[model samples]
Target: MAGSAARELSFLTISFDERLVEVGSNKCRDAFRELFDHFAPRLKSFYLKGGSEEAAAEELVQETFVLIWRKAALYDPQKAAASTWIYTIARNLRIDRLRKEKAMIYKEEEFFATKLTTHETQTDVTYQNQMNTQLAQAIAKLPAPQAQVITLAFFEEATHSDIAKRLALPLGTVKSRLRLAFTRLAEMLEGSKQ
Candidate 1:
């Protein structure tokens, strides 16, 4: 009797999934409008809770629905409900944005440290000066090839194989350079305290 009840519940769930897929596939605009109308507030709250600004959260919500329109055909009714799939898309977009933001920040820091002139009198000067000195010292300590590999990996965001191809070096050589560079950097930082 319990087994029969579980089967019945599964059947109902499948039927709902199919209906949503059909709605998404055929009456796409109307289906999306309905979904957006229902879920917009929830999505805004979701993004806000996840630390996005209200304006950015609203934009992300809109982008999510736009993706739904484009990727509706890729939805698998057997795998998830419409709400779950939409939420997953929203979450993935947020994570992608965060990664890009982090990469941009790192690039900016690298650029400013290299390009900006130093004025020793400013209050902000002390920290920037220390960072610049440490970074230069670290890079200087690395062997030329190892330093090149680390710079390409961190600044260009290249994979080991990509770095290998760019430098025309073997894959193992690129990996070795990265490992040796990081080890040297750690040791340099550690020794500087004494």
Candidate 2:
């Protein structure tokens, strides 16, 4: 395995570290693909040596490559060789994966525990309904013009400019109406809590 890795590293035709640098500065996909082709199988073997199954090894290898892609800009060729940097990423990911697997507390009744928690969901739904009622009452109190703008802006998901266009009002008028409407709604909602 050691001999194979050494031969593979030596077989890279281009300056692998330089290619990594290119990937960092330029986001060159082809450079990344080249790195992937060279390092993935070797990393897979290393993961398998650590007792990961084939699927786990492949997942770890893929995760390592993803980390390498995201953190390529942090890689310094002067500080470490490309192989060393890539291996470090693979090692870290595998360690994290193993930690997560071991961290899981196996409670066979865990699913049942979640299923039994209906009161919390019921409380959430009740709170949501109360808020909705307060909101509807507050909106009903808005003057017709302000309510129109609010309806368009909130319920219809229209931007201020779109509201302005739909109402044939100036942009400043639309903004002012929205500001006034929001201010009134805030005051009403705050007063309701008291």
Candidate 3:
């Protein structure tokens, strides 16, 4: 069994290397097709065994062949076997993908960091203090029940159900009070703006 397997591998190496040369020199579609058919599954298995997920394995195989097609003219059977050339392409593609993913994560973190810093540095502390004072006055002007729901929902970060349970009120009652409080706050804030 091992001997037969070795024979088959030998045959594949010889033919696939020749096919790659054919593809490079003649732009031969048939040779390219043969190479793709033989190597795609093997490349996918290689990636999967290297800890890539199935979908990622398939993607890497596709990218490797596309690259192999484009770069076939650069392949030199004198330097390496066809399988070696293909696997090297696949490995490079995987490394490129990992680099891109890492770069995206780094960019996202950088963006958020800059955004937070800008907001903090550019804020008008006096304006913020004034708005807080106005908001407090407006809440005090709300009827007791409406203020309670608003405070619980916004300040304490309670859900409507939790606010209702805390206040011994129905969920619907909590929602209505929050809506009314929002309307009053909007009017008061708008009036102050004018």
Candidate 4:
């Protein structure tokens, strides 16, 4: 409606950066509409100059406005002028769309790729999950001292020396427990396989 358009212009009374901050803090639809009014045409022209179809340019403008709304809080006036920052966002989004289209083209070319490969990948994932479950069960079966050492070494990704420091144990003691734990796990897994 003409009333909506007039309201959009009313927002021009404030600076663009202040409007963006208002979008950030208040999520005001009128402020957003104002921003859309100001930027959408300029963005469309920029896109058209770079060879986008009219519909695609319009879509990009809509998407850019959406980003402005959602990511308003991330805007910092100290970094760059509002126009420069907004232009950068639109440019990045366009590049991303082009890259995604290229990637999808490659994906489409792989449509004839074998179901056998997909099945094998699924089977490999299943096997890995089962092995992880069995290994966790085996670790659980271990005595507390051995389990503690194994957990610190593998689960927590602590080096043996780090484990020694964390647990206030001697390095030799930590190494011995780890050796015993590994031997027990090998035996347990072998029994489960049989």
Highest lDDT, which number?
3
> 122-154, model 2: which lDDT tens digit per residue?
323223233334555667778999999987764
**Clashing residue pair totals per candidate (backbone < 3 A):** 0, 0, 0, 0
- Candidate 4 backbone overlaps, count: 0
What TM-score quantifies how close candidate 2 is to the native fold? 0.45
Error of 2 at 99 (Å): 3.0
Candidate 3, pairs of clashing residues: none
Q: For every candidate structure, what is the RMSD over all alpha carbons to the true structure, in angstroms?
A: 23.0, 25.4, 26.6, 22.7
Q: Please provide TM-scores, in order, for all candidate models, with all chains considered together.
A: 0.42, 0.45, 0.48, 0.44
Candidate 1, residues 7-107, lDDT tens digits: the string is: 56445444444545766678555656666676778778777766688899899888877877777776654334555566666666766786877544443
Worst 10 residues of 1 by lDDT: 120-129
Model 2 regions more than 4 Å off: 1-14, 100-194
lDDT of 3 by residue, 82-127 (tens): 6656756665565566687754454333235445645334333233
- Model with the higher TM-score, candidate 1 or 4: 4
Q: What is the Å distance of residue 147 in model 2 from its true position?
A: 79
Report the error of model 4 at residue 87, Å.
0.5
40 in model 1: Cα distance from truth in Å? 1.4
Which is the leading candidate under TM-score?
A: 3
